[model samples]
Target: MGKVRKHSDSESDDGEIEFKKPRPAKKKKVETKTAEKSNDNTRDAKGDAIFALSNKRRVTVRAFPNGEPAIDIRETYVVNGEQRPGKGICLPLVQWKKLVELLPDIEEAITALPKKK
Candidate 1:
């Protein structure tokens, strides 16, 4: 707790009456480990930004040595202590962006589809 000082300094405080105790100085903004963000982009040693879908699957932003950049949505497996990409599709950045933009429409379309028996 802090001491409540008198409003004797109100004349110099732009006509505002102040009777409350002095507050502590502000600290730097510190982000927590579990802070939620729209996108969580992290990179691996191979220079690929990996977004893990599961223990065995991930979506990665990759740039090939041929100068082609792509978004890889793939499953992975550990072989001899190294993670290897499994059967999945790689979309060009342009196509990936388009897909992201269409997600809302896709959801609506999914709801409109007939249920299978």
Candidate 2:
């Protein structure tokens, strides 16, 4: 039998020298001017609110995707003389329906609570 040959770092198992081809660097994502213009227009076209409850807190119900309803419940406050939108819960149509169904029980629970002094 022939003697076994040792392989070098740059050599393949068959003793052929290997050269690695340089790969192109990945390109970063850049937002185009057209994309920015579309986003600006979408921001300007705010959805119309169908129902609103305004007390100490403000809650609004608006239709999204033309027909589906969404409820946004948030606090009303002012900062630097400008009214700023408060962070709050947003319920989609299904969850909003569930909340409506549970309203009777919720009212009962609230009525059962002791009155504040």
Candidate 3:
């Protein structure tokens, strides 16, 4: 004779039971030394190019993760005998372009201001 079993609430009337196993957590990727070094090299090269210019400032146009265009403006300065970065500003690409287009008018307005004694 075959063995008989009592049915639980989770078991179907047809005598079949469903089981589910818990999934394992995903692991985060670790950055390699070579990748870090390459990033540093790229940063150094960009810094050199910015400082090599007479303006000592650079504007980088990039896209955000959400697909919005952005402009980053950074300036280099000498602080305590070492080259350091100054305060930076970030704006939308449209605003940056508008600012560029209005540069001549802005300069004229600035020059029109009365000089301080």
Cα lDDT, all candidates: 0.73, 0.59, 0.58
TM-score of each: 0.56, 0.46, 0.40
| Worst lDDT 10-window in candidate 3 | 31-40
Model 1 Cα displacement at 111 (Å)?
2.4
Q: What value of lDDT does candidate 3 attain over all alpha carbons?
A: 0.58
Model number with the top TM-score: 1
Error of 3 at 64 (Å): 1.9
lDDT of 3 by residue, 1-117 (tens): 333554678645676555555667786544322111243232342332122234456555556678788776777665444455567887897888899999999999999999999
Candidate 1 overall lDDT versus native: 0.73
Order of the predicted models by TM-score, top scorer first: 1, 2, 3
Predicted candidate 3: what Cα RMSD to the true structure? Answer: 17.3
Q: Determine which window of 10 residues in candidate 2 has minimal summed lDDT.
A: 35-44
Clashes (N, CA, C under 3 Å) per candidate: 0, 0, 0
lDDT of 2 by residue, 4-117 (tens): 455677645666545555667897544322111243231112533423256335556667677778777776555544444577787898998999999999999999999989
